[model samples]
Target: MTSAAFDTSIEETVEALTGPWRQPRQMLHGQTYDSHASIHDDATAQKLGFKGGTIEGPTHFSQFAPLCERLWGKAWFETGCISAHYRAAAFEGEEVQAIVEKPADGGNYATIRMMKRDGTEVLRGSASIGIDAPASALDIRLTELKPLSDAVILRDIKLGMTTASQTVRMDFDQNMGELYPFSLEQKLKVITEPSPYYAPESAGSSPWGRAIIPMEMLSVLFQHGSKKDRLPVKGPSVGLFADQEIRLLRGPLFVGEDYRLDRQVVAMSGSKRTESLWVRTEVFDNSNAPVATMLLNLATLKESYASYDQEYAALPRS
Candidate 1:
């Protein structure tokens, strides 16, 4: 609620963490007319009933990095996985805290929650190491997903459609193109959690032998690359991340490493107000070894598009 709630002494404690964190919410945009023009802007988001531009859900994942490190140590950066469901929107300068519950078995898995200082839950999820661990928040949701029975905003996208394979790399000093639109140096200046591991000098000496990409930056590396226009999910409609999961299969992906990416539409579903497309993206090393996988749930708000009502009424029922 107040800045006083974020006491550094309390944050150093074992069970709790207090963060007066802020994110530059409006800066990131999707590759669409609506996403670039309105969805991520304050004035437009206000019209959609949100406080302001919603902070990208992946940005909050950075907040949990310290907690994960505390629980599982550096191995987390290599093999850790976080699966989360965005419960509510977070605006810039909104102080938030990540609370961690130690696993009963003293294992690598932990229950985690992010809440505003005023006690409003922003997201809920599970964090763990290893790919074979029990079902996490996103894992369970993946199983329960129902097929899209009615034509919604995403009706044009077919399940199993895949994005063309693309090559991607992250460099501590290079400027990433449109997908990221910023350099690592610029990102560090405003990053919510800054650590030496993200620096070239210090990180180069670590076991990874190079500046390891931060978990938050991994989203940029995986998403910000050249892609073939294939899936035709109507235009001028705004979409936001509803849920996300990142799993490191054989890494702490390093900066400046060449990695190949492939993504596929795995499922489609919708609610009264939104339609969603679930995609699974895989990353591979130069040797063709598996590196990491990202599961993203992109939800498009129905009200954002003017043709929703007429379009839905014309579709044949499943």
Candidate 2:
């Protein structure tokens, strides 16, 4: 199940598969949302107490591909799922490793984790093959969420609200826009796992016959045009990914392929310090065939919203 293109030696045992330590690059330093600098900007993040601009969470996904591919083979690209709940932010220059625990019964599902060299956890979740792979990490986390209440930032959003389907594509050198200002070519230069399967000239020689988008880029592809959807969540506040799940259906989504994305607000949740908006985005091909899906929990920090307490106090008590 291993390939030279994946370019990494996996440390495997009867219990787990461990990937090499990788220093994920930060490409979101200039990222903007709602016309303001995002948490990926050092100055903005420092205002809220982060030591520095955080590397976007999905950037870590690339490190797990080699391990997951070794465990499941090509099918991991076709029907694989990675569902993670962020435990802490990872910054540039920090070394992190990915581990996928082998299923006890050798089934199609397993738990996964990423940790810094200091043993600080970056994220923990599940990975599996098959659309029906037993409840993923986010699936379990969703059921446990306390219904959102006393919210200020996400008070206007409602469940099942969908956005207009929009078209998206990722060319090798095309910048993905404000939310992700870099191009696929720039990312490939530093991707944790380099695969010819993701390159134009060499892709035709691969099993898929065309370049397949790396799992991490799927996040960019789906989110590229999302801001235009304008789903009505109060903002001018900072939000970060708290949980995320990317699942492929009839995929190995190709690089340079055009896909339509439709997003929906599927759930709302709250914690002591943040209110979360859970969204589900579906990707479809030109012929309208289902390609992939993503579940993201965009958690807005309460303290970052200046009017949070004042607004919450104005709400009628139950």
Candidate 3:
């Protein structure tokens, strides 16, 4: 592409795409782990000071697809990436809008954000297309992380720890297990954008000629087997998605297709209120070809852990 043509594509005068207000559903109300209700449970959320069961952060990812597709066309589905830091949680029935700004610098990346009807920012980050679409929000944030300090819940978690490859699939009606109990068929009913590409019956009309999993469901699919991979984080405590990035290398991951997942602890950091475990999961097709990647910062609440302070005090000082 010529510099002039690229400049014309992302002129400063280009208007940002804003999506319609949509209410994302809370599918995790029944989510359980460590023999107890998860943070998504209403009671569990209230105890932690949240209004009610909060919608999953990734659920908002669906809202960005149409807007991004408008900006980058088909490339948005194949190599699209959304890197966001969740600023606040949104509950069911709360309307939210997604906005994607055209890059003023004529790059393949655009700044993106979501806002609740009450003007509260839900999440903010970047949306980019292609492998070379400049540095992502998480890519820049990862470099600015402060070292893990006074670790408790995530003290034992070391960077570079990789889990064994696990084979997984996301069939339309198959429930995604404990972490995500809902299936693709169930999600489509409430998904922010209804795509014929994602429906089995109309999939033949899609460019891929098969039903493709929605980008948001890719979050459920990647973490579907997380419980069985058991990393060393002391996690009877509740955790939330602090920040996340989903990038498709060879995507529009198909429905009912078998894939392999490999996860690694890429980094770890902590704040006064939460300890974070930054994990990166790589998805591969049956032929062992790379398909997609997800980077998640699971921030475990300090107050939710019973013996955080006691255990941290026991660790030997450096």
Candidate 4:
């Protein structure tokens, strides 16, 4: 079904996962993640003659994290999980909506999408959750843990060394103490405005009653799409890790401006079963403006985290 039909029932709230996402304009370009930058000025995306800027894949995939959390509960952060491949980009100013539909077999399967308000599909994906799956297995029942560092970015090596300037909106000179346990005053400084997709109540009131980075936006920024080169792999094997540590210095990200996204490499090590790399990222809303930053450690294995890719290829419609 189209976004219109899907969105027609926001109140029902019976939707599977995603919902009527607002296609806000100003929230564009200013904020981004690894994948977002990776795709913007790449070779294949350039040569294939794709129109407009290449949309990052991780940006799209993480967009749904909020949906899962909203439905499953904030604590779901430690419980539920998702993993998917991005098929395409959702351009700036495009009308976007997200929806989830169950597949025929029904068991732990779904069809999800990010669509332009006009009904033109932007990003189409699949979804599955092991509901009955033990919360312990998902770590939903686990106690929250604080990072051993001020947010561990790739084992050390500050997040943004290679990140060059690109257009972004908003600006921030954050007081690290103000984040984490964001104060009433701090909340006012960040979420300067509100929009449908992610609305901060008001300057005096916090978005979801807390001052923090727009989780959805932040998730997309972490995308490693065209922005960076994929880890070199020898086999079809893949490695995956859940959970992350974020330290938001500032921002509920405003609109109508330019920003810079900085990425710095952290650590790389090899194991008998896998190889991995870690990196730190700092997002500045406008030129030289520091809003919020994150120390993300992304990992991949020399061999698939699952079994052999050959067996994966044979699985019915993942």
How big is the positional error of residue 151 in model 3, measured in Å on the Cα after superposition? 1.1
Residue 55's lDDT within candidate 4 is 47
| Residue ranges of candidate 4 with Cα displaced over 4 Å | 1-18, 24-38, 41-47, 58-66, 77-80, 102-111, 117-121, 126-212, 217-318
User: Relative to the unseen true structure, what is the C-alpha lDDT of residue 281 in candidate 1, on a scale of 0 to 100?
Assistant: 92
Prediction-by-prediction clash tally: 0, 0, 0, 27
- Output the better candidate (1/3) by lDDT: 3
Q: lDDT values of the candidates?
A: 0.76, 0.90, 0.87, 0.39
The Cα error of candidate 1 at residue 73, in Å, is: 1.2
Residue 96, model 3: lDDT of 88
Between candidates 1 and 4, the lDDT winner? 1
Task: Give the deviation of candidate 3 from the true structure as CA RMSD.
Answer: 4.7
Model 3 per-residue lDDT tens digits across residues 217-241 = 9999999899887788795899999
lDDT of 2 by residue, 179-251 (tens): 9999999999988899988888788777878888999999999989988998887768899999999999988
* Per-residue lDDT of 223 in model 2: 88
Best by lDDT: 2
Give the per-residue lDDT of model 1 (tens digit) for 1-318: 111111122254555444444444435543234335555567667877887777777778877887777667767888989889999888877877777677766677877888887889999988999877778888889888766778667777888898889888887777776445677777777767766677775664566556778887888788776334356888677777888889999889988789999999988887777889898999999999999999989888888888888888999865
Candidate 2 local distance difference test against the native: 0.90
Number of the candidate with higher TM-score, 1 or 2? 2
Is 3 or 4 the stronger prediction by lDDT?
A: 3
Worst 10 residues of 4 by lDDT: 1-10
> Which lDDT value does model 1 have at 242?
89
Model 4: per-residue lDDT, tens digit, 1-318? 101101132322344654556533222222323222212333423433445444433344444545543444333232233433333455545556666653344344445666766666665544444445322211321133222222111223332335443443322232212111122234333332222323233322423333333443444433322134233333332223222333334444543234566665554443343344445566665446566544443444333333434443554552
